[model samples]
Structure formats: C-alpha cells, structure tokens
Target: MGIKVVKRHGSSFKDKLYLPAIAGGMKTTLKHFIKNLKDVDNLKTMQYPEVQPDDLNERYRGVHRLTKWEDESEKCVACYMCATACPAECIFIEAEERFDEKAEKRPKEFKIDLLECVFCGYCVEACPCDAIRMDTGIFSFTGDKREDFVLDKKALMKNERSKDLDND
Candidate 1:
C-alpha cells in the first residue's frame, strides 16, 4: 500500500490579478442584458402577487391533504403508516375505535407541523388507503405565529385536489 501526494500549482500572475474573471462576469452580464433588451417580452421576471407564473409543475408536492370518499368521509383508517414513514416525524395522529363495523379505526386527531416537514412525500407514498396526498398546488404559505403552520385534520381536508390529479 502507498500514499500518493500530488503537487498543487499556484495561480498565475493573470489569475492573481482577477481581471479575466471580472471580464468574464461582465461579459456574461452584458450578454444577458443585450439578449433581454432584444426580446423584452421573453424576460422571465413576473409582477409577482398580481401576476403569478403559470408554469407550476404537476408533480410538485406543495401541501398535504387528506382524501375524502364519495360520501365526504375521510378515507384514513388510522393505520399510522404515514406517521411511521415520515422521516421528519411531523405527522401526529390519535387513533380511536370506529363505530362502523367495516372500519375498525379512525383518527380522532390528526395534525401535521408544516414547519418541521421536509416535504419528501414519504407520507403520501406510505398511505395504503390513498387517504393522504400532497398535491394542493399551494407551495406558498405565510403566517405570523408558529401555530399557523400546524395543519389539523379540518385544514388538511379543505385543500382542493391538484389540477393534474383532479382529472383522475
């Protein structure tokens, strides 16, 4: 066994002066400025808030939501699969026995701390009942209080289906 050591070369006089780096940066800025000037309409800048970009990706996992069946009942069976799968441990669920014989259990309380969530979509993938999904198409969220970021079952249920998933 042998350890190989390689000699490192020092920067040349021109590189030390950084003139070429500055010139390259200026050239790039000038090229972009001229290109934008030639086609002002092609500028990517949007007048945000009033004019939102229309290029939202269909697969973007924006927000979490609980699915509802045709009768408007929650599809979750309180299996805790999603909570267990969450690497961030942001999902919290309290299971209770269901009155219906067909459904053995239901979530008495379900909450997800959006601030702690990594938005990795593992919860959605772990859901066996297709009860949880992250396709609300609402990537932006703002709040003054920490509690505002905590989404309860009601809030999760209110999210509309993503445009792409709505067709399904």
Candidate 2:
C-alpha cells in the first residue's frame, strides 16, 4: 500500500468562532417558535396523558396483540415461526394439542417480554395465520416491574379490539 500525505487546512476566523452555525440554529429555532406562537396546531408539543395523539400514520406499528377467531378461540396455532423469526428473541410460546379437530395446536403458554421486544413486526409477518398484529395503537405501555411488562397469552388476547371480542 502507498502512503499519501493529505495537507491540513487551517481554520478561518469565522470557522474558529462557529458563529454562523450557531446563528443558523438560533434563527431556525426562532422561526419555529414564532410560527408555533401564532399557530398552536403547528407546534410539535402535545398534552400527553390528557390528550392522546389521534394522528398516527396508517402503517404505524405499536404494541403486539394476539388475535382470536370469531368463536373467541385463539387464532395462533402455537407455530414457532414467530419466535424463530424475531430478531429480539422476545416471543416465547409453548404449544399444546387443541381439543378441536380443525385446529391441531394451540398456545398453552405464550409470553412476550415487552422489555426485549423491538416492535419490528417480524412476528406478525412470520405467522402463517394472521393471529398476531401490532395494531393496538398503544405505544405508551408502562410497568412497575419486569414481570408486569411481560404479557402472557390471556393478557395478549385481552388487547384485542372490542369489536372482535363482541359476539353480537
């Protein structure tokens, strides 16, 4: 390998001060501030807790939820595809033979460690059955303990939309 020596350029008086960059940043801040002052809607600030955002994009993926069939039975067949495909390795499933003749297997114990989940939607994509989805629109999940953050089969099933659960 041939060595090539690169000449170093000395900083100019303006470059040394960094005033131009600072001024440009401040100018942008002031411009946004003034614009926000006039139009509250334009402001990036949100009154969270009191007012949840309703403007999430159509394709926004949030917390994971387990879907159920029309009969309220679980849609998940306990297939290990989701757990295998998850890069974060957060999904855990224990399969048991279903009593129903139609379905061969069901998740006897399904657990997802929210603390470890990256919310990449890999699990949803890997599942052969459309049994898992990230459409809860719930990104602000909070827990006091690690165990509280971990969702079991029942908890995941509970997160399904009200309409889906309704027999009527």
Candidate 3:
C-alpha cells in the first residue's frame, strides 16, 4: 500500500490585505501628478520641431559619406572594412580598381540597409579611409517594404542629420 499525505489550511482570520502596498503605489502616482500640475509652465510635454538637438560628432557614424582627400580624391580604396565591421551587416560595398595611379580603387556600388542597422556605429569605427559616416541625427525610421529602407549611395549622401545628433 502507498502512503498518503494530508493537506493543511489556516483558520479564517484576516488583517488588512495588501492595503499598504496599494497605498504606496497610489502615493507615488499622486506625487508625480501634483508636481507636474504645479509646474505646468515648465513642463515640456510637447514642443517638437520648434526645438531640436545639435549636429554630428567629428567621428559620428550616421549615413555613409565617401570621404574626399585634400587632392579632391576619394579616400576609399574599397577595402570592405566598413562592411566587415558592421554588427548589423547593413553595409554592402563593391570595389572597382581605378586606372589612375593616384586613385587606386573606388566603390562600384555601396549600399546601406538602414532597416537592418542598429545604429551602434560600428561601421564608422571600421573604415580605414573614413569613407562612411552616420552623421544624420534623425532616429526615426519608417517603411512598408524591404526596398524602402535600403539606403543607396545617393540617399546616404544627401540624407542630412537633424540638430538632435548634438544632444548626446
């Protein structure tokens, strides 16, 4: 025969149930609500577009910009360092050899899928020639299809960062 276990229960006697915890939470909410009500003039619940942040870092990795040297030459030898270092793997680059002795190679087709980008700024750190940068401070990205987020050379070059980049 198998052994059986007995169950247990407490007699019905009640103190205040969870009233202190509830009161504490309510107190916190009321404190913040009253403070905001007192300082309605100082509160900035809205005021977008009218006020923005700052600009890019000296080395901010925003939208990629192919760097130009002092001689008006492209700095990128198309070594693919930026693509390899990108954590998001958003950077796609194709290199082509240059006939000119001064300019050895340039990107045949460089594309960055902003959709996949985490904005971690790894690509900017990996560039040997400073060919790519994420200077645009804009953080909002919206798209309906895969193609919409794929930022080509033209879009990256022209896409300007808002002033918010300087905030951080």
**Best-matching candidate per TM-score:** 1
The CA lDDT of each predicted structure is 0.90, 0.86, 0.71
Question: What lDDT is obtained when candidate 3 is compared to the true structure?
Answer: 0.71
Total clashing pairs in model 1:
0
**For residues 1-168, could you state the per-residue lDDT of candidate 1 as single tens digits?**
699988665457887888988999999999999999999999979888898556777678888999988878789999999999999999999999988644898899999999999999999999999999988888788899999999999999999877754546
Residue 82 lDDT in candidate 3: 84
True lDDT of residue 155, candidate 2: 93
Q: Rank the candidates by TM-score, best first.
A: 1, 2, 3
Q: In candidate 3, how many Å is residue 130 off? A: 1.5
Position 87, candidate 3: lDDT: 84
Displacement of the residue 56 alpha carbon in candidate 2, Å: 3.5
Instruction: Pick the winner on TM-score between candidates 1 and 3.
Output: 1
Q: After aligning candidate 3 to the native by TM-score, how far in Å is the CA of 147 from where it should be?
A: 2.1
**Cα deviation in Å at residue 69, candidate 2?**
2.8
- Write candidate 2's Cα lDDT for 1-168 as tens digits: 899988665468887788998999999999988988899876778889899777765466777889988788999999899999999999999999999855899999999999999999999899999899887778799988899999999999999543322344
TM-score, model 1 to reference: 0.82
- Which pairs of residues collide in model 1? none
Q: What is the clash count for each candidate, in the order shown?
A: 0, 0, 9
lDDT of 3 by residue, 1-168 (tens): 898977554333332466666788999999999999999998856565675434445555555555555675566778888889888888888889888775678877778887788878777788876766666655456789999888776666566544655455
